[model samples]
Target: PTLRTSLPSSSPSLSPTSIPSSSPIYISRSNPTIRKPTLAPVQILYDVTSPKDDIKIYFGKDDNDGREGPPKPHEVATNVLDNSGKKYLNYNDLGSGFTVEVLDKCVIKGARFYPANDREGRDPSSYKIEGGRRRKNGRWRWSTIKSGTIRLPAARIKVTEPKLDPRFPHAEILFENQREFQMYRVTFPTLKDSDSEHSMQIAEVELLGYFTGGGVSLEGVRTTPISSSSLIAESSNPVSQKKRFKSTGTDRAENLQHSFEEKGPNYLLDLTTQYDMVGILKMNGVFKPDHPRYKKLTDKTGAGFISRVKNDALVIKPAIGKTVIRGARFYTSDSEEKYDPSSFVIDGGVEEANGEITWRRIRAGVLNMPSARVDRKTQNIDPELHPHDGVWFNNDEVYDMYRMTFPETKDNSVNYEMRISEIELVGYRSTRKLEESNFNIYDLITTIYFWRYEGSLTVPPCSENVQWRIFDRPIRISPRQQATLEWLIRAYRDPDTCQRATVGRPRRDGTGNVDVVRPTQAIKYDHLQVHCTSANY
Candidate 1:
């Protein structure tokens, strides 16, 4: 499942005067558009986790609630344990141990655990506590802060010291280093000794820390667990997989004000003026004479049909080590709509010191060309397409890229060719200028809303290093344009072997249609972030 964080539509925009001097700032205009919410401080046990599905987790602000059964609809557990004279949150069935994730980043100096019953109250003989933090690149890293065996009668246990008195009922474990982290996990020994059985019963757990931000909110967090068997079945036969379409709008769509920014300058719009078109591979034929697509043996072959557009690639060398490409804008051709690429892939790479280009995939998905909209008065109307408007991907992990092989076009049998009047690439700088031009990339762009996530390239050697941002809207094309696109030929197929053959004779048999689109790929993991923007209109 995708975790969606919707920015408030009516969120207060940060004025130029309100920005902090310490923050890294970028200048779009004298008064650039920027909006971000204020961060706050908070301390709370946001979530508790256990690998065992049967174990129940209870948490609340009040320590004495006596409700029973599983947690209420949205609340954690309700029951409390009264051991001796002290009270603690009731947690039983110690399959092993559990983890607790705090609301936000904080420095945890220590923790207090109140045991329930005397037998179960005895601290684990051997225990270890671990901490985890999320990196800027969207990966989690964990390390152990302290680990050791607990002895009886050691009440105040400092991680550095050997032992202390007044232990058992309540043990305060202090750490040496007060490093900041988002979550922590505590594990216990699995040995089924007399003391180890049902030893996980705890009355209350308290963490000591200086936290930042309102405790982690689980409001929009979604989780979908995929099994290995489902993956195997999808890989074995892709056609059997269900097709799904992504829906538009969030609950807060009406109140959110979005701001857009790229790490580097927008050099993609200047490609035609700054870079030279070094190559162009046309979709002509190149097959053998013996191929069945040919009418006669002498008229055997021509250049075989090229499946995808090879000439569409435009390489760039940015000065920065890492480039985050957010989204792209595609333009239609003047004469042929079939020449427009309905689906495409974007790749990013760094020219290594050894002169090898280590490529990383940025995005691979479908780009829908808008069709004519029907009107009540008129039979059909031209689509409201513009050069600045961006066509977005659904961001559906399962079907958006994986299940659908071709663009949602009128005819599936026609061969599609890669044609474009212009292609805009964002978030990079060009090495040198090839010629001079007055084209302004920003002029064509209107306000855009997008969803971003960390993903790998759709093609092979799929490295998990790319950051993807998909726009929320789509560009439009005319009905005639859609028809022309479906009529384009991808390749000439040999009727005999049903393989690609050169256009020997004008034989329609075994003719390949325009289908240069790659199917959507499945999202392996579920860490997705969405950044949305509304149009000025």
Candidate 2:
């Protein structure tokens, strides 16, 4: 858990004028563009520290009925069992630190620190402050805000302002050019004396910032046990029986469709591939040289055919390490008649060796899929469940793709396709901690029964550098809610005239064929591996 401390009650609500003019700072809601913060003393997050057992109380706001009055004394503590009933603010050695993150978007004007009394060499002398903002891809990037050393006060002055000169240690520093930010991380790089190995102690840290009214509100952020939702569901019996196949069969596909449950250890994939020249392999059908629909299927825009149905795409934080995603398979919802066809692409990446992870979209994360004809002859006679209109991509790229289940009608009538506006992307941090996610560990892990086979991208360029892993375990989705994603895959339109790119063309979902599952293709020489919680199944 990230270490955080709140302000104490009984501390007076300060106005900008309280500080000396040398520090010139302002804290007011007079600017309509920047609203006043709804919450106060802001949260403090700690890092790189062990304790020497010392207690310090902060005086600020009270938690009583969530009301803000005067600054009162409050102890900083985590309710964890080891530190239960004890409120000690201690940093074992040097280079220990903490951060203050505003609950909302705000402009930080200035800050002040109050050192703990009686701590001589343990008091922090030099510190570094950084500002951070969230990127479009939902990752944070920090920039240096200020850094300086302060002189320890001798008398018991309630509040003392230290002279901060970037160059005096030597130059002058100020926040005259305040920018909107959501976080300010403060690191105590050095104590009063470099020769001393004593831990640092801080009684209180305060920040002055006005809300920008634009960032995510940390007030509603919470951590609770993951329940049955889009990510995972409770099962009386997770998996019944498991079987393998030297060659694909009806029973194997059936078992893969509904028998297995999402659970167990997660295996990391090597997802460092380049995006271009890469495509997902279509297990059921690869684009054939002589097919009549060849010209349209090979068009630069893969959105031509499936553009009629609203399609949705989601992006999830990949598991730690190199996440090698060769191929993805879908499962039928408990209340659905068929599995919705979708696509996924690697968009961004992060290296976990460093404690911090920053996500960025991979260049070649796009996929191309040629429409596979649903068998019109056997539409109702023999309903084909898993149509082979497989999602194909070239293996030269690395990215994370999240394909959501389309909504189904309550009466099970029409299934909607993808839509541009309806496409959803949920960012995640590769761990089981749900503080920033809607999924749990169980939702990301699955017992996969897979067989590798050499295949070609089912679209144009017909590149054959594809290694496919056809999973037998099905990923479940709620049928009734899946169709809501139909608008995202709507037909392509002319950017200039706003007309359909291909006039009179049938939408991917409009084809009368219900079975899109490609006919069982023969598997070539390749290894078969089943990854699960237990080998017994």
User: Over the stretch 168-283, how does candidate 2's per-residue lDDT look in tens digits?
Assistant: 11111235323555565666676775354335555444444443323131113211111111121121111122122122444543333222212421321112111111222122
Tell me the spans in candidate 2 whose CA falls farther than 4 Å from its real position.
1-92, 134-140, 156-174, 215-537
lDDT value, candidate 2, whole model: 0.32
Cα misplacement distance, residue 136 of candidate 2 (Å): 8.0
Stretch of 10 with least lDDT, candidate 2: 16-25
List the candidates' TM-scores in order. 0.23, 0.25
Candidate 2, position 187, lDDT: 63
Residue 280, candidate 1: Cα error in Å is 59
* Lowest-sum lDDT 10-residue window in model 1: 395-404
Best by TM-score: 2
Instruction: Give candidate 2's TM-score.
Output: 0.25
Q: Please report how far candidate 2 places residue 520 from its true position, in Å.
A: 99
